[model samples]
Target: MAIRDAGDQPAAGIYGLSIETEPMEAKLAKALPSGEGWQYEPKWDGFRCIAFRSDSSVDLRAKSGKPLGRYFPEVVALLADLPTPNFVIDGELVIEVEGKLSFDALQMRLHPAESRVRKLSRETPSRFIAFDMLVDTDGMPILDKELAYRRARLEDFRERIEADPAYLTVSPATKNLREADAWLSRSGGDTDGVVCKRIDEPYRPGERAMMKVKRLRTADCVVGGFRYERDSELVGSLLLGLYNDDGLLDHVGFTSAIADIEKPELTARLESLKGGPGFTGKAPGGPSRWTTDRSSDWKPLRPELVVEVKFDQITGCRFRHGTKLLRWRPDKKPSQCDFRQIGL
Candidate 1:
């Protein structure tokens, strides 16, 4: 994949996609089968990063190919200060406190001020838990090599690097399926799910070369305002609304994991038909049971996008978990995004 030029654009987080980036998805298995070709590992709950190091310069990019260097200055400094400075690595960016991953600390890295970022870098710094070796010290891509070989190379590199609890580390993997299953079940803390990869498979960059299993669930939502991350950009999140008999677009939920990456572009095309009373009935009123004064954060848009979110659970009408971001259906009208989809 071609390297994207990192400019002033917001580092692609959940809403953006890297130009060469492929969505990481899993193929559903009719039944969980055991096989020699498969190797399972604990899926981590953290940011996906591709670290590019060239001599003294290091760029930590998000899965969306956005430069994450600013958000993680300590990671950049650590990578630049590494023993080998000309290798590219793929890994998860996480913060482990008391041996458990802390995603809240990771989210704090998204601040806008450089001074604050630098300060936080010193205090509560981040760690790069490497899992794959994309490039070797010779500046050649090694993604075509088998997983066993890559694991050996990664182990060697980890051994050579200076250990900094806040900046760099290695992610451990187990080949035992039961152990992997155990990690999947131990929730409540930080384990996101389980990822199964082929031991002999070569690193298929920009491909869904692995299988991910998460505890899947679903929710019903109302389509509210559709905000574009940027002007002319595709819809970022479908501002979800719920209704009462009075008829209004109430700020209730949002579905961002629309599987259709290009769906937002199509949604923009349909905005021309937006002027009608999108949500009629009792719209979102004051703060709900979970929110505070932020109730006003919502905006009213023409109700035209309806989506069913295969989510985990709900705190209220809002998803208490990170949504999988499924695909968009033009076939389903806006009004179809309703409470019936909400799990009982």
Candidate 2:
């Protein structure tokens, strides 16, 4: 018998391709280590997008490789009207307010109503904080080129475009690590973190080539079930789960970021999926080093939902802090959810 190599196989979707998804990701240790050769850039807090411009038609893809053109109509229009026809740019979709990035404003762009989205697009209009030039004017993948060269190409592409407020601008890199640290520190509410890239290294698409150092830690958890608010039919907390050695969903943590009004409906939906082993091996037991006697307050259900959660840390297979509900994952299966998704 021979052991299998998981790394030898390509990941599914666009991740399998040697293409950059989001220019700056929160995994900077690979790109920038202590006393190393690297160029650091401010990590913008916004949507991760890949702008694909093939001739006149333009398509904006989200970090999940989903078509984001419909969600961000204004960006699609701007990309279509760009000077270059065929080019792929990896960047962040941000909204600027008073010379600072505004993630709250960017969140408004996710409206399902096209009319409202178009209205907000005109009112608060988004900007493309382009950082990487994957496909140059020649329509060739520059993944083999050094970071310095690719950045220069990105700069040239920006110069060719008309400085329209609708298009905003591109993000520039800082050679100084101290300055990058300042950007990471004073980023406050605007910046997400700092991304450091090796100047001499080539873009290793789908690989952790560059490095990102975020101010806070976050993790993606499987929503095994949800608990209702006391005395109310509203969802209070989402029961989080992680897979264990026996290939079973195990209760890990919980998130209670559900809104006041939506909780009622959400709880009803969650109650419908109750029963069965919500968690298998090492289920959430009583008080330990991290949690207290309040563990009994939580309720379990059949694992059916998956959600992306943002947390500060993890201790004893549980979240160190309460997580914020980023979004629902109807497209992702519960089995796909696991603790391995957490980046080291």
Candidate 3:
């Protein structure tokens, strides 16, 4: 979550677009907007990136305004070699594994070692899926232009430059609501969900001018462990686990959405089941760069309780984010909660 200061701006700039400029964001919605003038695109499962190229200088920036060039050298090289020199684009940085986009592979490219990054780049090369054009090849600013206009220009720009479709691809977009819904229904693997944008409105950087509906799904998980709230004995979060093929319960993720009124009784119930080994394999509280003294403290459970939780995405056999507590499942056995539920 580190933010780069103004001093960190690069010496070379792309048109007038700075690397510190934030990309236009999307607000989450339950469904896509039903009306005309709305364009829908596939919500790619990757990093939101802004790619800039001017002459021989090229830069790749994350949505948080952090530099990403070093981590994706292959993308940088691709942009530097492009026939079109002066241009800025909004895209997603993705890596495909076995024909499906892998967020875990993209995350692995962030290693500090150049040798490790180079090896991953060759083994699993990244792709830039362009969805917006901020600046045209003629140095014409496109931010003030309407989405419809910019999208057309982006298509034309792609053909003019002859950008390598393998590395630099222009994302497909549709105005049909049924098509968008179909994309959402088939959302998995490479596609995360659907993104809806106002075709008549201009690009508003750092603003939630677009809407996104993530493909959410539910799963049954074992209550493998629990963490106490900081400075209090009340239960904080329920650590969720799923049994692998080897019959070992591995910590997939946690859900801290427990209702406050149920904490005292839940805490008591958790304490009673804290005797047996919690997660037999790949347990939580592992050493991580984001780990802290208080965050690492967790109590083990007997793995007898089962709860159904809602999750959006999974990476490396684990939930990419904390899940939402739905309700206890007395009808389902803990052994029934396996990796197959989440398609691991």
lDDT per residue for candidate 2 within 176-196, as digits (tens), equals: 877787887866466767887
Best prediction by TM-score:
2
Backbone clashes in each candidate structure, one number apiece?
16, 3, 0
TM-score of each: 0.61, 0.75, 0.65
Q: Model 1: how far is 225 from its true place, Å?
A: 3.6
Order the candidates by lDDT, highest first. 3, 2, 1
Minimum summed lDDT over a 10-residue window in model 3 is located at 286-295
Judged by whole-model lDDT over C-alpha atoms, candidate 1 comes out at 0.61
**What lDDT does each candidate get?**
0.61, 0.68, 0.82
- In model 2, the Cα lDDT at residue 336 comes to 46
lDDT tens digits by residue: candidate 3, 1-344: 12222224574455667666778877657788898899999999788888877777777788666678888888888887778778889999989899888877887876889899889999999999999999988888799999999999999988887876889899999999999999999997688789899999998987767888867777779999988876788888888999998999999998888888999999999999987799999998743332232345889999889887888878898888778986675434587677764545
Kindly list the per-residue Cα lDDT of model 1 for residues 204-271, writing each as its tens digit. Answer: 75554577665554333546665554343455555666554344455655555554566656566546
Please report, as a residue range, the 10-residue window in candidate 1 with the lowest summed lDDT: 10-19
* Candidate 2: residue pairs that collide: 27-212, 28-211, 28-212
